[model samples]
Target: MVSAQPHRVGAELWGQLEPNAGLIILEGSSRKYPYIDAEALVWGGAGATQLGSSDNDATFEALVMTIKVRDPRGVSDTRLGRFMLSTGAVRAMHIDGGHLMLRARSKTHFEVFGGVPVDGNIEGRKYDWMVGGRVSQGLGNKGMIGASYYNRFNAGQRSAAEAGGAAALRGASWVDPSAKISWELVNPGLAEVLGTISAQTASRVIRGELYVTKRSPTRMLQSTSLFTVLGDPGTLAAGGNLRWRAAPRLDLWVNGALQDAQDDFGWSGYLRGVLRLDDDGKGSILGELRRQQVATSSWTGLRLASVIPLYEDHDTTVGLMPEFEIIFPDHPEPNQGNVWPWGRLALRWQPTKSWAVAAAVEASANQIERYDVRALARVSYQGQWPKK
Candidate 1:
């Protein structure tokens, strides 16, 4: 790993011979305020290979690059490019092309982006492209209004399989076009509202959300969201949450979502409460209840977790966390419900400002049937190099 102010780069390489697994990764990023920022990454891996086989053993797991530039005034631009050789590339979406985005602003703002795939497969084709843009006008204290459109094209230009079969699978036009109108209503410290209505070649959707919060010795917050998708059967969803901290030591929260699709309706709810025993919150307990019903099946569960300080001194501290959970399923079979109990004991020793050691062990069991255990230990040291 290498790092500097506003810049960082890291890489990891690992291999195992017993089962024949190997991985290679390289990533780096840099940022310069009010000027430019850039990042690049390449990662690939392979598993279980024969020493002298003639098969293709190389895979181009993932490659990505991003760059952003901003002027001191009202202009900014960004570019993103990606290529994936295998679907196992983690933490990134598969993209075989590059996209460029530009924005200019004053009171009214305009944004545009376009991309063309350089490699990989899309919609049974070897190449594809997309273009999109948005325009927005500021409304002072009220908020802003914007409209955006995006279109994708050339989705079936090449095929690795039968030409006819590929064409048939990708449909007549591999292009998708979508447009949306969005509005924002801002009230600053009190509340805010946002809404958008969008239509695509396949479906139309409307979404709205509201948030209200108050910050004080006793904090409170509330949020709600609604979504409606106009597809073949259509679907509607609504959800909201409320959280309140009556004191520094106590808090309560609840959230639930309800969805209706055609003749089916489903909903889920979660409730949680927390209590702290110390001003620093080093000792705390939490309890949660969750319930969900989908189609014809439903389940409810309760969980309780706690953290207690076993020993604490000037430079060393030890803690323990005990957790328990039980679930009830809406089924007629016996032994369908289970209880899980788990606990973790941890120790931390920091004798100096530059060195520390920590260790933890966790164990759990299900309904007194079977048990599993895990242990972890780590030592860390930190130091500063001489300035150049």
Candidate 2:
């Protein structure tokens, strides 16, 4: 396992049970404060068996858990867990309590999956299972083609608690389904192109999309997508990005996107440049300029940010980062004709191999109409044995 911090907890066990079979087990957990006032925990375990010559011909089971806790103003939490089991013949089963999924794959590149509702949500929303399948065919030196489909029914109930009265409760149901087809072509050093067409039904409404992407050896990428909703508006969008290595210590990137809809058309573009003063991004400076327009709102902005290491050791490091942004709105009347500005300062410290802490403060103003301030602090710890 690999980690950004020096401390972790992980274990593995392996043994041969027979001439043609073997068993393996693994467990690991890690905690980190990747951002101010936010603590995240990631842990998981897996077990597997080998029964044939090919490594793919094995049985395996795995489970993962993730939790995040944050307090920028008040405390908030998010948690999720997943469990899966699979056999050697490409058959698998997975459950997350709220839903269960089954999958099967064949050597001919055909795959299928089905979902079943195992439990309802806190608000009593019940899903009525889903079935999906995909088939792909390789075109040898050309590329590949694939098609997929999925269908499901969703149901929900309005509880008395939310409706403010026991007699006000109600239930609703909808049938939803989607289908897609895609093709790809690859030309080494020249370009790789992919195109897809998709359609979906939601709450009796239908929507369709056509998307395409192209990547070339010139450190550039481009994409375009067109979307339409039956009896509604349509949209066409395009985007492109370019990156330049420049030097070992400096890098530059530019990105732009344009969108056109029945009622509005707008474009957004940005350029960013970064200078690294250290090999590990411990000390770096970045500058960016962005321009955007959409409907009646538009803005041109510039941002600068930097990170500096205050102290460092084999197992610990202390750092600081400061950032600032300036904005000018094209519609001065809506923005009060005043340039908006925002700034943030952060401090982070890792005093031990298994512990880290961070704190940050932010201040912003909206054209003299309002001013806001916020602050946050977080701490995390991790430990491991039998270090590898």
> How much lDDT does each candidate structure score?
0.48, 0.48
For candidate 2, write residues 1-388 as lDDT tens digits. 3234433543333332222232233334343433122122222222212232453345443333323332222222222344332211111334342222222222224444444433333233454443445445444433444444333333522111100000111121221122221221111122223333433344223333344343332211111111211222334456655556667778787777676655588888899999998877779999999999977769999999999899999988999999999898877766464688899898989898767777777888777545766565556555565454
Count of backbone collisions in candidate 1: 0
Each prediction's Cα RMSD?
A: 14.8, 20.5
Which run of 10 residues does model 1 get worst, by summed lDDT? Answer: 159-168
- Give TM per candidate: 0.53, 0.52
lDDT of 1 at 232: 30
- Per-residue lDDT tens digits for candidate 1, residues 80-120, read 56532111101122454443334444556566555554432
